[model samples]
Target: MRAIVHEEKEGLEGLKVKEMPERQISDNEVRVKVHTAGMNRRDLAVVTKRHKADDPALIPGSDASGIVETVGGNVTKFQPGDEVIVNPGLGWQENSDAPPEGFEIVGLPDHGTFAEYYTCTEDHLERKPEHLSFEEAGVLPLAALTAYRALFTRGNLEAGQTVMLPGIGSGVLTFCLKYAKAIGARVIVTSRSESKQKEALNLGADLAISTEEDWQEALASEQVDLLIETIGNATFNKSLGVVRKGGTIVTFGSTTEDEVTFNIRQFFYGQYNLLGSTMGSAEELREMLGFISDHKIKPQLDKIFTMDQYKEAFEYIQESKNFGKIAIKVR
Candidate 1:
């Protein structure tokens, strides 16, 4: 099997395509012939040793769409030739480290779907949404699951609520916009680039405002019921400013700049609740996959690259040039 392996944590330069031994599936696991692999910031971080690089040699992809080429003897959910998408997160014996409530995630602190062949538990595989191509399905697990966890699970986003989403370029934000609009919520999005704002509008955002210079003034009179703060630190206060009193603020990642400091009094004074969200569970991923299939929701892809071109794909993501999810054709 050919795979892009991280030989060491020397950044992208250390990533090399090589022929590695095929992963042997255990009796409780199933093997997939990966068609497409989703690239994420965490994968880059792991490769560069910024996040987790415990293993010097590792395959660094978490989300993938593929065909089940073989199933373990005990597996009942899948079989050879089944079209599937992997929800990367599995359960743990320790309850505290377990996934919150209903969901689990893929691609972190575990072996992921970065190779031509990968193996996982039978339960983690879900039927790919019929409406999506393999390339599209590959990008859904991590991004869509995070959006579902943040908006529905933690933020308690309601149909009629006004939601403010900070930063609108990534697939996660786009998933939030599309799902929120589908449920009749008023979606408000902000981006530093006008071009990104236009892109957000095309995806059904009710209000797309440029945050080039404190554009919270655009919504000064209106208050949001929930806010999704991906770019924390720099925009946390502004995010707080736009939300109504008692509104929930769900935070996920701080992509722009980290090391955020804020006045704790603001939360007490405003009666705001700050909720921290990570990726979703495998069950949530299944639900999202079913929902998108039923609703015919499509994910926006910024670009696609083959396994050999993985370096260029990461370069595009690092440069922030792509509009949404960037994928790698692993097969």
Candidate 2:
């Protein structure tokens, strides 16, 4: 098998593609011939040491869709030739107030999907949505699951409500825009790039504004019911300003800086709900797939690169050049 291996937490320089031994499956595991793998901000974070990993040699990818090539003795959910998508989150099986202590995402301490072949427990695999291509399915798991849980599960977003998503270009936020719009929510998005703002509107956002613009002023007539905040310190206070009184704000990532300052009195007086979320449960992944199938939603794919071009893919994402998911064609 050929795999992209990172031997140190020193950033892109640590990454290299090399021939590796094929993975072996356990009794409850399935070996997949990876067709495509999706890249996430977390993959870059781990490579750069922003996110810590205990493993010295790590295969860094969390989202992938592939065909099941072999199954272990105890496996029953899938067999050879079954098209499947990997649920990147481990543990956290069902909806809960919070993930259990032992919960961990795939592609960190464990070897991940950025290879010719990968293996995971049967419980973490799901049938790929029929409408999506392998590249689209590869990018759907982590971002779609995160967006699904953030909007519906944590934020409790409903149709006809107004929701605001800051930093619209990332995979999760793009998914958020599509999902929220599909559910009849009025979606408003902000982006530093004018092109992304226009793209969001084309994707069903009711309004798109520049982050430099005064979003609170622009949206004065229609306050936001739910605000998905991912650009932490740089945009959190603005998010607080745009959300309606008593509205909910759900945060999943801090792409800017983690530390943020906001008016404590305003938060208490408004009786607002500030929630934190992460990658979702397996059940949510299942439901998300069904939702995508039901709504006929397809993930926005920014670009697809061959495994040999992994460095260029990483560079593209690092430079914020993508409006949606960036994927690697592994096969």
Candidate 3:
């Protein structure tokens, strides 16, 4: 099998496609022939050394869709030729207030899906939605699951409510907009690129604004019921200003920078809710797939790269050139 391997010596420069040994399955695991793999911001972090990996020859990818090629003795959920998508989050099986101890994401310590073949526990695989292509399903796992947990599970988002989504072009944020709109919610999005703002409007956003402009002033009269804050310090305080009193702010990532400072008095006086979330449970991933199938929602794919073009794919994402998910075709 050929896989994308990243080492500490050269960081991102060290990333390369190399022949590797095939994965072996355990009693409760299955081996999959990867068709397509999705790239995330975390992939970039790992390659850049911002996020450290315990393994020296780490295969860096979390989202993927493929066909089951073999199953272990105890694996009964799937068999050969069954199409499946990998659930990146390990542990945290059911709904809970928080993830259980020993929870970890795939693609770090464990080898990931960026290869010709990968293996995982049977419990971590789900049937791919019938409507989505391999490339679309590849990108849906991590981003869609994250958005589903942030918007519905933690934020308690409901139809007819207003949502403010900052950084509209990323995979998760784009999923948020589509999911919210499908549920009849009014969505307002912000992006630094004018073209992205325009694209958001076409994707069912009620309004789109420039992140560079005075967004608070533009939305002065509209009180957002739920604000999904992923930009961190750069937009956290401003998000507080646009949200309605007693509204909720659910944060998942700090793309700009972590450790934001906000007024303590304002937070208490306004009686607002501040919540933090990460990748969701396996149950949520299954539910998210059903929701996509039910609503007939398709993930927006920005570009597809061959396995050999992995470096160009990484560069495209690092430069923020994509409006949606970037996929790597493995087969």
Q: What is the lDDT of candidate 3?
A: 0.91
Please provide, for model 1 over 100-219, each residue's C-alpha lDDT reduced to its tens digit, 9 standing for 90 to 100.
554434455555778898888887778888788999999888888888889887887888989988888888888899889888899999888899999988888888887766656799
Against the true structure, candidate 3 reaches a TM-score of 0.97
- Which candidate has the top score in lDDT? 3
TM-score per candidate, in order? 0.92, 0.97, 0.97
Lowest summed lDDT over 10 consecutive residues: which window, candidate 2? 49-58
lDDT by residue for model 2 (285-317), tens: 898999999999998999999989989988999
| Model 1, C-alpha of 299: deviation from truth (Å) | 1.1
* Residue range with the least summed lDDT across 10 consecutive positions in model 3: 49-58
Tell me the tens digit of each residue's lDDT in model 3 across 1-331: 9999886455578788998888567889899999999999988887786434444687889999999999999988999999999999998899888999999888876878899998998999999899999999999999999999999999999999999999899999999999999999999999989999999999999999988788778998787999999999898998988889899999988888899999999999999999999989999998898899999999989999999999899999999999989999998
**Each prediction's whole-model lDDT (CA):** 0.81, 0.90, 0.91
Which residue segments of model 1 deviate by more than 4 Å?
51-55, 92-108
Judge candidate 2 against the unseen true structure and give its global Cα lDDT, from 0 to 1. Answer: 0.90
